[model samples]
Structures are given as structure tokens and as C-alpha cells.
Target: MDDDIRRGDLVAEGEPEQEFNPGIAARLPRKTVAGGALVRDEAGRILFLEPTYKPTLDIPGGIAEYDESPYEACVREVQEEIGLALPIGPLLVVDWVPALGVWSDALAFVFDGGILDQPTIDRLVLDPSEARAHYFLTLEEAAPRLRPSMARRLARALQALTTSRPTYTDFGR
Candidate 1:
């Protein structure tokens, strides 16, 4: 099992801590579920979507329907956002947030997706209600521009995928 730590838990540079605070935790509201994809192109660039209602860029995904699994939600989200059907691989990260009083228990599935051999990203068929544009970026190029949470999440996901070890972690809980 992965180590669990509370928000305020502190550790020295060389020490490892595993205990976590279970209290002060925000419970899930009916356990909201969602999924996203870490879609990479032939040139190793990752895809990101700029949300219409939000300034931060995000992965393409939406809440999963009651009958849908996380994987199913991911496939559906990609099709809805980009009008493309691509194969999804293993789960990379499962993130949890509680401070916002919102439980975005998300599963990120990695995939060898994106327009094949296309150097330029075409305009996306984004849902105006959800996103305004889509773009591709290398990890280094996108790091500085993404929200801190998104950048950290992506880094964790990429590490998990490369190491073949899936990770599940809670935040603000």
C-alpha cells in the first residue's frame, strides 16, 4: 500500500513517513467518479484542453455515468472532446480532493493516442460549455504553463506509467 500523509504532516529530508490523518477528512458526496487520458503523440507531446469556463488547461474527461466504469468514461470523454477513438492503457493515477467540498476521484488512463504522424494539432470539436481549445505540448514545455495541481498530477501520472506501477493518493482529505 502507498504511504498516506496528512496535509500538515512534516518530514525531514531523509526520513520517510507513512501515517496520515483520517479525521479532518471530507467525505465524498455520493462518490463522484471521473476519468481522463494521458494521450501522447508520435513526437511524445501530450494533449491538453483549455476549458471554456476555466482558465486552467485540463485533460479531456467528464463525470462517469452511474453505469459506466472509469475506463468507459475515459473513452467516451476522448471521443466527445476530440472526435477520435483511441485505445486506452493502464490506469496511471487516482486522485482525490476534499477541501473544495468536491470529490474528483479521477482515474487517468494512459494511451498511445492523438492524430497519427500529424505535426500540427487540428482544431478540436470542443464542447463550448466545457472547453474552448485543445493543444499539444511536451512535458517540459507545458510544465510552466499548467496549474500547479495539474502539473504535479501529470508528473505523478507519467512517473507511474513509466515505472509500470499505478498510484492512488488522496489530497486535502
Candidate 2:
């Protein structure tokens, strides 16, 4: 390691980047971790869900349960919410969301679900308790229907698809 490399209290030329110090870890503030999948249609339109619990539309995803990875959580959510055991691709975006009202700060991720043809789209089974309807729309048409930060992060997710690399998106809102 270079002498310029530094992280937290333990600083040395050859020190590793991550160290397991329980004392320091226990004091770290916890942020909510969420993961979702961005599924597109053959026409390249995004699949959006009208969740019963909220007014605005959302994608297929949810908060990670204890001992669950972000990718696992996203897959579980897709099955639970949309009743599809579809394949989940690589991560596209990770965003930092500020606390609003009663919610704490959060780290959210978006994964690529690849393009779904019409037949597969027709097979989606929505859980009435989670979502009422699903639709496919262009990002421009979907933007106004989502939270500003979400819209921005989603746009970044779409862009990252072309570069084939994960994007870190922060709206700072």
C-alpha cells in the first residue's frame, strides 16, 4: 500500500482498506439498504408498478432483510410483489438518499433485469396487497410520476446500462 493511503484511525503504508474493529463498527450509524430491478420491455420501455401502499409508481424491489444480500433481496421482492422468478442481472446503480420525515438515510441499489418480451410480460402476476397495476413507459414519460431523486437515479441506471458498469448516483437531496 502507498503511504498516502489512509482510512479511519489505523494508518500505515501496507494496511488493508477494511479492518474489523467491533468498537468502531458498533458506533457507526446504520442506513437502510434497498434494492430494486429495472426491467425493460422489447421496446426499451421501463416496467413500472403502481404500488397499493403508495401513490407514485415504483419498480420491483424492497428493503433487505437481515442476512440478505442486495441482489437476493431484489429477487425476493420481485417474486413477492410481481410473482415472477425472473433472472436478475448485474447492478446498474447505487444511490444515497437523505432522510425525509420519519425515514432514515438510505443506500439504494438498482439492478438490470434485461429486456422482457411480451409473452413474459403477460405472465407477470401482481400481488394485490403490494401492487395494483403494472405498465411499461419511456423514462421521459415515467419521470414526472416518480420522486425527483428516484427519477434521477433511475436515469443514471439506464445510462449505466450502455457503459456496462455500475454507477454511483447521489442527488444530494
Candidate 3:
């Protein structure tokens, strides 16, 4: 309505100009995505990796890289952790873990690596830098060794394996 105003102008008088600020978006909470595989031996024991950097034992997986899908990351991580290049099966579990202290919330995925043959198990290799040792342990034996969160996730994952369906958990429960 004023002489200085131009036609088709989006801003109205007395209204603050608005712009999309990436800084504000960057401040929003982001969940880290990770993928791993649940592999088993002929005796029906799950395979666990003992990471060199962490005092805790972890599954055969790692954090997903930028622009990498969860499934792809699973395959890559499995190969990196233990020199295996087997095809990864369908996703079995998706666990949303809450933030604890300095760590951020994370969405972790588990894929079915299927049962390994005796020959494959015998040929398995472990990278000393990534994994110090690998073991095949029954569910009962592995429970106490795994962190509480991982234990719950493994339980749900085993249930998924039995039911032949995918399972989801919040905070590893």
C-alpha cells in the first residue's frame, strides 16, 4: 500500500522477515544409526565379537557412514570386524536406544546373517585391531557377558528369529 512497496512481495508490514536457518536445524537432536548382524554356528550358538577398543563385547556391526543404508552398513561392518564377506539377510531387529550421559540416542539395526556351515566357521578370520577375539556362545552363556542393553536386544532378536518376523524395541526393551 506504500510507494516503496513492490507488487507480489511476500512480507507484510510490521511482520519480521523469516528465513530458513541451517544453524537452528543443526541444533536439533539427531539419532546415530548403526547396523550389525546376528550370526550363528551349526550348534545354534550366536557369534560375539570382543572389540579391542571397548571392554564390552559387541555384535558384528558398526556405526553407519554418511549416505550409507543400514543394510549396506551391516555387510560392510561384518567384513571389517571379521574378514567375512557373506551376504546379509533380511533385517531382524531395530532397537531405538535412548541417550545416556555423553552418548546420543541411536537407532540400531540387526540383520540375519543366517547359520554358518562348519567349513565357513572354521575359515572365519578376526582382525586383531578391530576384534581381539571371537566366540560362539549359547544364549544363556552369552547373557551375562553382554551389556544389559545388548542382552535385551539379543533376546528380542532371537524372538524375531523364532517368529520369522521383524521386531522393534525402545531403549533395548
Sort the candidates on lDDT, descending order: 2, 3, 1
Per-residue alpha-carbon lDDT of candidate 1 for residues 60-133, written as tens digits (9 for 90 to 100): 77678886777778888877887766666778777764445343444343332433446334534677777777
Best by TM-score: 3
CA RMSD, predictions in order: 11.7, 7.4, 11.0
> Best to worst by TM-score, what's the order?
3, 2, 1
Candidate 3 residue pairs in clash (backbone atoms < 3 Å): none
lDDT of 2 by residue, 6-49 (tens): 24324544655574675786688888898899999999999999
Total clashing pairs for each candidate: 0, 0, 0
Which portions of model 2 miss their true places by more than 4 Å? 1-27
For candidate 3, the lDDT comes to 0.86
The per-model lDDT (C-alpha) reads: 0.67, 0.87, 0.86
TM-score per model over all chains = 0.68, 0.83, 0.85
Can you list the residue pairs that collide in candidate 1? Answer: none
lDDT of 1 at 85: 65
Error of 3 at 8 (Å): 36
Q: What tens-digit string does per-residue lDDT give for candidate 3 at 1-173?
A: 23245333535554655648847766888789999999999888999998998787788988988867788789888998888897888888999998888989999999998899989988888988899899999877988878789989988888898899998999678
Better of 2 and 3 by TM-score: 3
Poorly placed runs, candidate 3 (over 4 Å): 1-22
Q: Clashing residue pairs, candidate 2?
A: none
